[model samples]
Target: MNPFDYEVDILPLSVEDGGGFTAVAPELPGCRSDGDTPQEALDNIYDAIGCWIEAAQEMGRPVPQPRRAAA
Candidate 1:
């Protein structure tokens, strides 16, 4: 498993062209995904994050920590 943490920010869902459910990641830039349904979108995005981490490691890059921002 990757050495990091996770936190999901529940935001209002949105619709996109071609009709897919979308959710946003509160922390990472350009880290969002869509799916056939809300739950699917969540699952898809979860897997996407794993791949993102793998790519980052293979390329000798640092993975971002999912820490809550200070208010």
Candidate 2:
């Protein structure tokens, strides 16, 4: 599955938190990444999504389908 198919939530980090953006895939628990900018965070999250799916598959866990937004 394409990681881009998944929905992502990006949040900015405060200065005390090292000043980077955090990207998370809410459907995939613990699937997240951090980077210096929103774009970077998004890129990292895509990679993270792929890894999350791969790991789940290797462990015989079902990968959830991405939820679609209402039209």
Candidate 3:
């Protein structure tokens, strides 16, 4: 039931563009992170999602549900 369970998209960045992977949780606006590797980007995005949910909860905002994965 963790909010970080939302579907994530990982994209690779070019060397001139800082050379890292970017992870984004599509269901949560502005919830994303970048890292030197794909795994690191995923890990960072999980933390970002948690923080985003917590902030939303603290402000009495509705937290969005995780989108089901495609079959």
Number of the top-ranking candidate, with TM-score as the measure: 2
Alpha-carbon deviation at 19 in model 3, angstroms: 0.7
Q: What is candidate 1's lDDT per residue for 2-48, written digit by digit as tens?
A: 32244544344544466767756655556677777778877767776
CA lDDT, every model vs. true structure: 0.63, 0.95, 0.89
| Candidate 3 per-residue C-alpha lDDT over 1-71 given as tens digits, one digit per residue, 9 for 90 to 100 | 48556899999999899999999998899998999999999999989999999999999999898878443
TM-score of 3: 0.88
Instruction: Return the candidate ranking by lDDT, descending.
Output: 2, 3, 1
Residue range 3-58, candidate 2, lDDT tens digits: 88899999999999999999999999999999999999999999999999999999
Displacement of the residue 14 alpha carbon in candidate 3, Å: 1.9
* Backbone Cα, N, C clashes tallied per candidate: 0, 0, 0
> What global local distance difference test value does model 2 have?
0.95
Off by over 4 Å in 1: 1-5, 8-16, 68-71
Looking at model 3, the pairs that clash are: none
Worst 10 residues of 2 by lDDT: 62-71
